[model samples]
Target: MKNWLRTTLVTLFGFSLLSGLLAGCSRDHHADWSADDVAKVRDRIAGKMDLDAAQTQKLDALIAQLQVLRSDIKGTSNDPRAGFATLITGDTFDRNGAQKLLDEKTSALQQDGPQVITALADFYDSLNPDQQRKLRQKLERHKSWFGH
Candidate 1:
């Protein structure tokens, strides 16, 4: 009986350690972009660009690709916000938790920003010079409201 208890304890301990390690590994690879959010952004971009059917389809695909990549990145990245969603259901706010979440977000943004920039470049490069200029203006005007 004692041996069985010891074995069960050891198994539980092993599972706990394994879970923690997997959690950390996951933080390094996730990106959080929901489908609805992706569709909305694509619609906005398409509208601003006055994209033709071909351009719209291409843009939609790009947005979908980016969204999926973002979700993957969020999964692998460590951001305090990972736990923030639960805060809404809980009774109190944990300032330390909030700070950690913010820190994670800042770190994630720093690490993943270049990838987003590269993707933007790909999209921009596909546009004609006139369209590019217009796109730039639109982006500049909305920059404040974006990335929030």
Candidate 2:
């Protein structure tokens, strides 16, 4: 019994130490993206597309537009579950209330969608045939959620 307890205790300690080390290695995803990180990603994308000066400018504009849209969407909701809770509180499902909640959420998207679309269009139109082909190839290579 003493030998068994000693081995169990040693194994538990080993696991705890290993878990701590692994947690230290893991990234803090909650941290916001820094400007340098954004720039590096932009530069990498620009390099991949072989963007000219004007094309690079357009890409930057698109990135800015996307960031704005992201901010707008993120700012719209503090707790998504809170909105749904109201709709389900009554005995019957409140269709009107649900619709209102959806509309409220979608309002931000509706407002910002046009700008995102325009920026995307401008960027795509700026790309030459080779660059467009490369972009399409890269997109096609991306795995879907179903792993196609």
Query: How accurate locally, in lDDT, is each candidate?
Result: 0.66, 0.79
Write the residue-wise lDDT of candidate 1 on 14-79 in tens digits.
957965765655453324546776678778878877776767766765665566455544555356
Worst 10 residues of 1 by lDDT: 24-33
Q: How does each model score on TM-score?
A: 0.44, 0.65
Candidate 1 positional error at 66, Å: 2.0
**Tens digits of lDDT, candidate 2, 1-148:** 7999999999889967965664553333523788788899999999988999999899889989988876765565555345556765898878999798668658879999999999999999999999999988888787573233
Best by lDDT: 2
- Which stretches in model 1 have alpha-carbon errors above 4 Å? 1-37, 76-119, 145-148
Which pairs clash inside model 2?
none
